[model samples]
Target: MCPVQLDGIGPLARFSRRSFLRYSAAASVVASVPILTEAHLARAQRNTLPKNIPPGAVRIDANENPLGPCSGACSTISGLIPEGGRYDFDLTEKLEKTFCEMEGFKPGYVMAYAGSSEPLHYTVLAFTSKDRPYVTADPGYEAGMYAAKVNGAKVLMVPLTKDYAHDVKAMVAADPNAGVFYICNPNNPTGTITKYEDIEYAVANKPKGSVVLIDEAYIHFSDASPSFDLVKADKDVIILRTFSKLYGMAGVRCGLAIGRPDLLAKLQLYGMNPLPIMAVAAATTSLQVQELVPQRKKINADIRQETFEWLAASNYKFTPSQTNCFMLDTGRSGKEVLAAMQKKNVYIGRVWPSWPTYVRITVGSHTDMEKFRAAYTDVMNSSTAGLEPMPLPRRLRETPFTHLS
Candidate 1:
């Protein structure tokens, strides 16, 4: 089928900043904070990110694993590359059943999506409505609110607790009829976790019919999470997983959604995604080789802890992150700091306005961190270069590289 026709879009469906913006603009229902000017955006639009750029620009903005994929997964994808013409049933079934076994989840309770994003977007579209608003933490996962807006559901953005974790009580109090209550554990940008018991308490008392989606996308890299026992017991909760972060399968794109059979079944309304043979092969192999994830998780934790030590010694006020990324208070415009870092070929994450003075940086390799530290020192020391350049985070659609669990 012609994909463009399916989106009711023309030949311009390719992924450039402008095309992506055009398609997403019509669907924005949530009131967004505008910050960038036409002139500023025009520069980014006109720039093609110099092709010969070096790899020194470590990408922490998108929360990607610096490790790309494990050896077995690499082999699997390499095996599948030449077979693009074939259906990927065997590999997909192997993945589904193996994931169920490994995760201690039932195969029936699981469904695979190329990435967690489509399922996130699809799940909201399938269940939410004008009367049943979508409730989430402000500065939490923007994807959920974006999904709710596409469906014309009211978005209630509750503020985070002073400690920077999701205010479970406040979120529960926001909208009783909420169709989807989203909590990103070890919440993004902040890198702090909300206890599993807290989530269970909220889930137990959630609006009688609403679904609680606990995104443990970063859980593998952290300590234990609220277990998948809820999904096993047929509770009204869904857990999302991806092979991106530690397993290094960001580009391979394999993600899973676990919940009660009925709620998982509701996903049928959106129809099945044709699992790419390549992704299926890579993800399935990644799951079978579980040691790789644990090893990488430890590496990420070690790197993160070391960085925290430095932050502490330097008297940097930063959020405590058990995961792979954390926010640092730059004491100034984070956007300008981000740009400054970029100019030095060390792209830290964007400036999150929730703490306008803070900057979020994804935990990169020790080598990358050293470069980042050097770049940061240079930027701070440069005479009269302390001001942050404001950026208008364009209302772009979700990252096309969405399997980012």
Candidate 2:
């Protein structure tokens, strides 16, 4: 990724070195809030009895892998419990090495985190500021927007193309002083893939000293090619990978940020905690399972396609998706449909302001999707007037930019 040189006279320069230091320190503390986790995001979206999620609720809201950790990963986690008292640094090293080998990346090009969100946030904080605006697709993942707001950076939300893919050209033209162009491939909420050519164009044409942050959190669930080759080419790009999706370790929390060592070094300014030993062990074992990705990909794809077909036959409008999640355009306010589904005990995902009528749906297992289909049909067939509007929690409503899938 391109190193953001702070030599010019703008926000980075005007903000004194001492002030920047204080800001970084304060932001680090803020970023550590536990509510930023994936699970908490679902709770924030629903604004219901979050602390007491119903026991038998068919929860397809979070885009979590319903299969959970594989047998091997479970066995690994169980075996590693006794050794959890001490940090297994080698396990972390082994995971990094194995991932690098699997992807043909150099050793220092990767660093592990609890989840990709940390690095994602850090990258935005490191590169963006008032002068250097953050550019992202409209209705895209909002974590980067949250980081941008934290850094006092302007956010330029570019609308996606007609097919719901990232409008790379429009993104490049969004702002000349753009510091980071955030792309979530098999993008969250929509689950649509932006073409590789579009990504390469963004990387090739982005402003000088700017970086393209590509989040591949759901890459495994789709057939689209990854952008790791851009890293190998030493282009200005940082690619994020997470075991939270197909590997089924959302709660376990293990992820990677791949880029040049210099780019990775910039993210360290925000400070990072030591790797969790249990997560490291589980992730290491998960990476070695030969058939895990292919097997899970087929399962998720099958269910997602089936759901799409049902929606099409029922005359419901939806975004055709490649990943485990897709957006459905309710004929009325998305919040009404969300509440209706909640009443039916089939919890779905949140809505983006850009698409007020579209509610995201996470493709769960066969039975979970079936429950979703029934609840969705019932909600769509009924009038939305009687559905109570469940506003987001106070904090989230106050800062609507923090809404992420």
Candidate 3:
């Protein structure tokens, strides 16, 4: 990892003399800085619900692929169980090789992890500090912000554009000495795509030495193009990918961080360990199935669209989402509606503070969504006069369910 250096007009210039010294000291031993731990992964990925949910509940709360892994991946995982005794680091290398070849990325440019959350946290920890703030969209994914908190970095939240896209221009201006500008394409909660031009603008115009981190965890579910060219050009950019979404490997846990070798090396400053061997085999086999991405994309798109159409026809308000999840505006407090839905055995996503009346809903299987439609309609029509809003302190508190937020 490259150490921070003092220059006349460099990134450290914005810091006071004392702050700069502290940041430099922090950077010197960054490898020892603890960030989000194993427990954080679950919170970053989904809003936790009650543990006693019936097994048959329509679980559309977490943005998981109900389709599970493809047949090939399942078979590969099953066949590899006996070999689990060994670390089988070779399997990880093969998986990385398979992905690098397919994506046209140089071998060193991509680092595999158990899930995207680890790299996401590491990237934030490596880039942001007390001197350099972490810039992100309000009501966006909160995992990076959690890392920023640990690093003592100020988290500057730029509100989304009127259409719910990341306000890249606003983000660029949010902190002149920003360390990492994060954009989650087809943004979470809203699931709306920021224009590719806007992303390019952030890259070209961002402060020198600052990295533009793009979390493309939902890219496969949308028609949005990947930002591989930015990494290829050796720009200060990092792209995060995960099998947890469209690959239906949320439980399997395989992901990648793609960027210039120097940029990726910074993330390695935290730590690197052997990935789950079964995850590697499953991811490798999944990649070989030529039809996987498109087929699963279609499945998610179809189900999401069907849900959107129902919401529209029923005159309910919702964002025009292109991914497997979308924000739904409940005429009342979203927290109330979410609880009511849960009572009906339909668990949905949590509400973002910026959009208190908007509850996020993950697109589940056709049958799951059908139940959601019925339960949602019933909840909206029924009385919730005494259903109080989630308290501010509780909403922002660091719980196992909401630590990321």
Candidate 4:
């Protein structure tokens, strides 16, 4: 799609230096609120897990990398255990420097966090407000919406294009006073990519003072170009990266946010806690492994393709995903399929309200996926009697912005 001209925007165009300062000050106060505490964050993560997940269940949910950290990273973490007592070792600085050099970013263009989630939340809190709305793809990552609600910002959910990519033009037109445009490459749940050109269009034509937040959490799994170059060009964009996916450090919890120094500084007003010593050490070493990304990318792609072939042979419809997860359409209710799979000890993913009949399936190891194929076929062939579709909660069904004013 062609990029549209976004000239003649009024108050949004006047997003001056004074306006930034004022927004940042207000965001800082919101960040200090009790809801953003460390305990709350930890609790949220725990809640994503299914209760009483049985041991040995084929877990293809959560889009987690089955392969843990690389050998080099594991060794580094083991070596750094003794040094954990010291809070101010230069390991975190080393990680930032290494990432900057690797991505050709200038000094201070990147900041490390526990995971990409923290920076993602901070970006929404910093840029969005009641007047300035948060615009995101309808079935996109839900975390940003929650953060926007915390800041009392209007939430605009733009539907994806026919190809399952974010409709950049529609999103730009959704809200003239948009503060943050969140585009998740290889979007969660769907595991599909919004084209890089579309991202550029959104960046260039978005409402003035709006920041384009690209979540590249699954970028390594796909062949799409990284958005880091936009940061190098000093565009009003923030790119989030994490060691959790390809590097397999989800539990280790190391991630980075790349953007202009001024933009990143605004996030700091919310919170910039110290990095864990072991996670820093592991992440630094992981970056040094020359062949780590390509090797794991091949492994994941091959397994995902194999699973796709199986679904096709079984005459089931599925989304073509370049990442480690894909969506499968169950002929019956998705919740019923999920429950049947669980009965057979095969745990898959949650369903998005936008497509209640389709359930997400994370690409697991070869053996785990084989188990999934067996369990899924059995569930689909069985009777769906007495199985009711679970409706989404009212809070999740309605946009948070509607309740405001």
Identify the candidate with maximal TM-score. 2
- What TM-score does candidate 4 get on C-alpha atoms? 0.87
Q: How displaced is residue 47 in candidate 3, in Å?
A: 11
TM-score of each: 0.82, 0.91, 0.87, 0.87
Model 2 weakest lDDT span, ten residues long: 1-10
Off by over 4 Å in 1: 1-55, 383-405
Q: Which scores higher on TM-score, 1 or 2?
A: 2
Given candidate 1, what's the lDDT at residue 241?
A: 79
Candidate 2 local lDDT, 1-405, one digit each (tens): 122333333333566677577657756645653325456667776646544458788888888999999999999999988987897677888898888999898878888888898898888888998899898888888777766776778888888888999999988988899899999998887989899999999999999999999999999999888999999999989999999999999989999999998898778656556788989889989989999999999999889889888989988899988998999989789888888888888888888888999998998989998888888788778876767555666545554342212
Which 10 successive residues of model 3 have the least lDDT summed? 396-405
Candidate 1 residue pairs in clash (backbone atoms < 3 Å): 36-392, 68-248, 115-403, 336-388, 336-389
Q: Tens digit of lDDT per residue, candidate 1, span 62-82?
A: 678878888898887887788
Give candidate 1's error at residue 347 in angstroms. Answer: 0.9
